[model samples]
Target chain A: MLKNLAAKAIVPVGLTVTGFVIVCSILLYSYVKQDLVADSIQREVLLGDIIVKATRFSMLTDQRESLRQTINDIGEQKGVEHVRIFNKKGVIMFSSNDEEVNQLVDMSAPGCIECHSGPVTAVHLGPMDQARNFVNAQGEPVLAITTPIYNEPNCSNGGCHFHAPDEKILGTLDIGMSQAPLLKSLATLRVRLVIFCLMVLVLTVGGVIALLQRNVLLPVRQLVYFADQVSRGNLEINEPEGTEELVSLAGNFKRLARRNLEADDSLRDLQDKLDTLTRQIREREIGHKSGN
Target chain B: MGFLRNVRRPPDTPNRAETAAAPGRERIRRLHRLAYRGLWGMAAFLALSLVAFNHGWLLPPISDGARAVLGKAPPTNLISIALVVYSFSALVLILSRMSTGQGKYKGWSHLAYLGAFYVFYHYGNALDANFWAVFAAGLTIMALEHYQMWTFCTEAIRKEEERLAQAERLEKFKS
Candidate 1:
């Protein structure tokens, strides 16, 4: 029956296990999401650094076209959303998207908030400062990394171009990478985690029910059947065999049955003896009466 | 009928002391029965409380009292305390029922005490690594004692009863 002890016991255990599994799955999903975001930021930052390093020589030689070509080539790579070179005035000097070049960028955007948020005029770029995530114009997720190009002594002291020695930073190279692929993969992982949790819950409940049937329900049912037989005065019925505890209980019942049958036999014998003695005494009295 | 016809009536007799003691003995027996039932009831209550507390299914006043005693949050699996209380109550019940004259029941009482103690110890320290070893040792000792008592009661006592019955039957035939 659905209302049996096995069902009752298994329901609580199943609920506990399922709850634990769901909690663990949620924790795992959060951890994985954080790790994925961190990994993506690190990769994009490294890419920005490489782009800056590759274009430094061209910028030093004043080969503007070659520098722009290098930025454009890197931007065209798989997962690369956009790459741009910007001046200290927040002006886009070069860009993978040509239309955006020569346009002034908004300094208050999410990508620039890390550097512009403080009273300190000069922002010291660190590894963490180089990367950020924001929603693009199309509502797609984008990872933007800003790598600063420092003014070197060679550029300031060179004969071709005049530069100020006090200029701490020359420009910033901004690289934006698409997060669509990473998001898709994470979505797949989430789905898989949900499926896995459901499977684990099902398996746990099913296994518990099976074990309860084997270890408890079957033995208890057998004992109940044996008890019914005993109650009906079937003393000759064989004992039910089961697990060690059940076997011991059955053995005790069988011994009790045997004892009861022995007692019944003894009582019957005593009653027969008393009956014969009473008949003999009755006959003796009748004979004596007749003689008198 | 013949037996009653042949029997002679004895003189009417009364014992004031026996009459005075009868009520006292009856009262003591009633008290014993009540005590046994009360102990079992306490054990049942303890079990129900344990379940209620662990599952957060307690009534308002009892829940408030539990929270006040054990703090706002208590461990959910406190079945061990319930088990210990139940076992101790059963042990006391068995001991109360045992008498000096009933040798069989006395052995049973001792066995019950040991068994209850073993249950308490085993469940109380169920999280321990040495649970199986301790349980095995207690079970072995209890089983040996049980076998000895059972053998004495069944074999020796049954043989003596048979001997007495045979003697009685022989005397009846001679008479």
Candidate 2:
């Protein structure tokens, strides 16, 4: 079967198609994965904003205990990694974990560097830039969103507040969520994509082989048989069937065979005539000799 | 056997050629019965592809089967399937014509397989089993045609070789 012409044609085609499917599937899966990651980050960013707003009243009223409780409650929620509110000086004023409160954080951290990476720290950053992804101390993937708190007029004008009106930024709200959900989604996507790719490859290649076997290989074998018989001078053989070209070729061969038969018939007729003429001449010679 | 036996040849006449050729004629007839059956098989496959492609009555089973095997929702866009079918069929038709020529075998023409793959990828969401089914059927048809043509040519060559060998033997005998 390997030596057959159909195999020679189909093996290369199947390989080429498999290569194409693998490459295209990988590229497509990567594209979809990137979108899912970005979407996950976007969701984290939105959640950060909502948490910041929920704690706004407590922060404005100087309710440090209430704000701390709110942050802790949010951190205890499912998939919530941590929630921290930091002062402009990078001091962790209120944190979900008590151990982290009052500790000074580095201004150039993954969650902070997006805004503080420049020569001067940025007063405001877009939601996308505010979101950052990293692995936490436990080696688990995390998506963190850093929302800067802008100084409002009420804060500076209030009796309990000492913030200057000129201060454009007050502090930052940083929240991190576990990336397990997003990773699970991505993993599922990858599996589905791979399965889909393999399925397509198999169907296409399998279909090709089936079609080739029926249309090409089987027909070729039959044509070879037809030719073998014809070559052995079997003009009474049936016409082989296949593709139009093969059928046409078979028709031509049949015509040629018929022509050969006609020529042979003509030869046989002339031979018979010669035999009859020879018999007549011999009989005449015998009669003439006898008469002499 | 029937025709040659009915001929009014002499009882002592040498029937060397007919005696040599008659053995395999029955086998050839049997093989051709299979070829005719294959013609019917091709027709059935073509009919299946058409049913698989159409959106009307018979599509659901084919589509569902494809989906179950695929492990996901298959693409259902008629326009994309139509485009792929059109382009792939046109390509095979051209290749078939090119293959019939006695010129150099264009191995490069097989690159069209890659092009078809790319087209599927470009319309990735629209690539489905129905499109592939149709495409595979057309390709198989063309490939079979080429295979038949190849066998026919080879058989002709073999016959010519035999003739040449016979002529050489006859010349030696005459000399």
The collision pairs in model 1 are: none
Error of 1 at B78 (Å): 29
In model 1 chain A, the worst 10-residue window by lDDT is: A15-24
**Residue-level error in angstroms, candidate 1, position B43:** 32
Note the B-chain TM-score for every model.
0.32, 0.35
Question: In model 2, what are the clashing residue pairs, if there are any?
Answer: A216-B144
TM-scores of the candidates in the order shown = 0.59, 0.60
Our model 2 lands, by Cα RMSD against the true structure, at 18.4
Candidate 1 Cα outliers beyond 4 Å, as residue runs:
A1-3, A233-237, A277-292, B1-175
Who wins the DockQ comparison? 2
Chain A TM-score relative to the true structure, per candidate: 0.89, 0.87
Query: What is the interface RMSD, in angstroms, for predicted model 1?
Result: 17.8
Q: Per-residue lDDT for B13 in model 1? A: 71
